[model samples]
Every structure is written in C-alpha cells, then in structure tokens.
Target: MTFPTPSSLVFRQLFESESSTFTYLIADRTHPNEAVLIDPVDSTVERDAKLIKELGLGLKFGLNTHCHADHITGTNLLRAKFPSMKSAISENAGSKADVLLKDNQTIEVGQFVLECRATPGHTDGCMSFLLKDQQQNPLAVFTGDALLIRGCGRTDFQQGSAASLYNSVHTRLFSLPDNVSVYPAHDYRGFTSSTIGEEKVHNPRLSKSADEFKTIMDNLNLPKPKLIDVAVPANINCGVH
Candidate 1:
C-alpha cells in the first residue's frame, strides 16, 4: 500500500530486508519536482532512486534525522548520485553535513515546509519532522525511533537514554496537536503508523511517568540489533570511508 503524508507531499515506503527499516521519499505534491530522502538504507537505495527518476522529480536533498543503528544509511550514495543535492542533518552531527539542521529548523519542499523538531532520546541527536499542509495544518510528525507506535527505541545504545527519551516524547512529541499524525521510523505487524492523539492516549510506554519509564526501559531484555555493529560505523562515517 502507498504511504501516508500531508496533502502536498507524495511519500513512498521502501523496506530494507536486512533491518526491516523503512526509508521514505517525499516529493512536493504541488510541484512534484522537488524531493528528499529520509533515513534511506543502503540496500534499497538504488530501487528508490530509480523510482525518483521515473516520477520525474529532481533529488534536491537527503536527510538523516540521526545516525541509524539498524542499517547503513544511503545518504552518501544518494549525495553521489545527485552531486548537487545537499545532505542535511542536525547541527550536532558536525563537520560532516553539507547543511546543518537545527532544532525547530524549517525546509521548503514545494507548497509544504517541514519543521524539524529535535526529539532527542532514542539517540541524543535524534529528530522528528513536522509536516504542514498548504493551509498550514500540522499533518504528521516523523518520529525516528525516539517515539514508536506502541513501543519505543531501545535505549542501551549510541547516545540512547531512557530518561531523555521520556522527556523528548512528552515534552516535544506528545505536546503536539493531537490531530497530528505519528509516523514512526519502524513498526512490526505492518501497522506502520498512528496519530499523535491516539499515541498519547493509547501508547503503553507513554502512559508512565519519567521515573517509571526509565525503570521499565532499563529492564527491557532486548538483544543487540544484528546490524547495529555494522550500520552504525557506516552511518557515522557517511556509509563509507
């Protein structure tokens, strides 16, 4: 099925088998001429690029909300393909980006301008993108592992912290207009997304206080992700040396 996005954006979900990660490509629906790739994993980059070409959209930029631990980010590959395209990321990711993004930063993509919300928790530098329609209705927020549908990202790795995650969600994400949609970086069972209103009221993880959230998150007996050891270094170095 096709992905969900604001009325002025066209988004596609490309799955990477190695990590079950979803890479999204959003084009300005109004212009259909400008596009950006978000958290693109290396495995499916080529397939996604071909689709972008077929759609007749020019790749203008690529964004990595944060360093990924599940699969290699294809940012470098895409940057190479569209040499003029800027690789935009958080300012925290210094000395590497063609453009440094800051908290509450904004970027224009046709009729819609996505506002960056720095929701650090899953990783200290993690971020979420806020999409507003042409009329400026807050459409959705792309939570990059920091906030998931029913669950959240494990906090035992790279700049991850349970308390930080707790604050980030409640203060930064949950505080959004309930009508805003919640688009997570990953989800199992094919139920790819949820609305902020729904998550605030229904997410089991979000129901607890920060202290309780910390205690519970600290106890989760999750195993290290298979690709974490590989994907991280690759992503930190922009996919390669």
Candidate 2:
C-alpha cells in the first residue's frame, strides 16, 4: 500500500531529562488520531499522553526497543489510558509484550511499516526499528542503545556481548544506505541525530576492528545505572511498579 504523502506523517522526538532517553511518536497525519510511541518512560507517561491527546492522536502501540535498565517503561500506563494500545518488544527480550516481535517483522501503522531488525548486543534482545516509506525507501532507524550518534550502549551487562554488538552494527546497520538517519535511544551529549555513513566512518567504537572493540568494551568498568535495581524489575513487568 502506498503512503498518503510524506507531509502526512506525524513524527515527534520527545525526551526524558533523567535518563536522557528519546521517545518517538509516529503517526499518519491523514489519520491524525492514530499513532505509535517508542521507548516511553514511566515518569513521562502523563506528559506523553497529554501531547498525544493535545494533537488529537489516539495511542495505538507502545513499543520498547528492548528491556531497559536505566529507566522504567510506560507501556502499562499508556495501555491503561488507551485500553486499545498494545505493548511490544523483541521476542527474545523475556518481558511481557502484547506483541513479541521477531527479527525482520514488520509493524503496520496507519500507512507505514516499521521493520524490526534484531541488533542484540547492548542486551540479548536489543532491536532496531526501521521506518520506511510506502515505496520501501529508507527513512530512519530507531537504534535502541545498539548504535548511537558516536557512542553506543554499554555491553557489560544484561547478557551484553561486544562481539555480538560489533557484528550487528556492521552487518545489520552499516549495510544500509549512507543517508539513512540514525536515531538512538539515548544521547547524553544533547546531539539529536546521525546518519549511517557518518557513524560507520566516525563512530570510535564500531569503526575499529572487532578485536579492538571487544577490548574497549571489556576494559570499561562503568558504574551500574542508578535505577537498575528498581528499573529492571519494573521494566520486566511493563513498568507497573
């Protein structure tokens, strides 16, 4: 099916200050009331819902790119407000997902399709969502902590493996067209977006050999996320806590 028009797409980038997480909202402007949200935070549920309502958009889906450890998800709360809204995550994430997405699965929105590509590394079930045009042209990729502007998610916990992450970024993401925009789940530097070409040549971590990448990931003894204890459990249950 062909999309209404490029201008008929409603895309919003929302952020949560505490976790520096980016939540995206995509809807067809032709049907202004139907929308999908990605990587929503528990604390921002009311804020997100208010914006959706203010825009006269009805929530259709609450999707998590993966199980998060830094902050809780708002999928349950969103479903409470919009009973018809479904929650989804990667099938291997081992969480409660109304929809357990498989690799390469396509999520049908109004007139667009979100292609799910498993990019496990930051976590065993990390997935990226590729938003494509009706003609199947590449638009952008919502790379959950898997690939960032110039950095990436920590590969020291939650079944993280630097080798897996390197392979995912190289084969799954870098293979895309150079112009494809990359929208990561978090960015502490406040920068917004990047492209596949830029990341391939400039991403300090992934630009190097796989062996070096693994070495870097192994040596970085980063501290655990402040909310890991609370957030992980809450996120495991869809942020009901």
Best by TM-score: 2
**lDDT scores of the candidates, listed in order:** 0.79, 0.90
- Number of backbone collisions per candidate: 0, 1
Please, what are the lDDT tens digits per residue for candidate 1 over residues 68-101?
A: 8877888888877777778777777432667778
Which runs in model 1 stand beyond 4 Å of their true positions?
1-8
Q: Which window of ten consecutive residues has the lowest lDDT sum in model 2?
A: 1-10
- Report the alpha-carbon TM-score of model 1 versus the true structure: 0.92
In terms of TM-score, how similar is model 2 to the real structure?
A: 0.96
* 201 Cα displacement, candidate 1 (Å): 1.5
Worst 10 residues of 1 by lDDT: 1-10
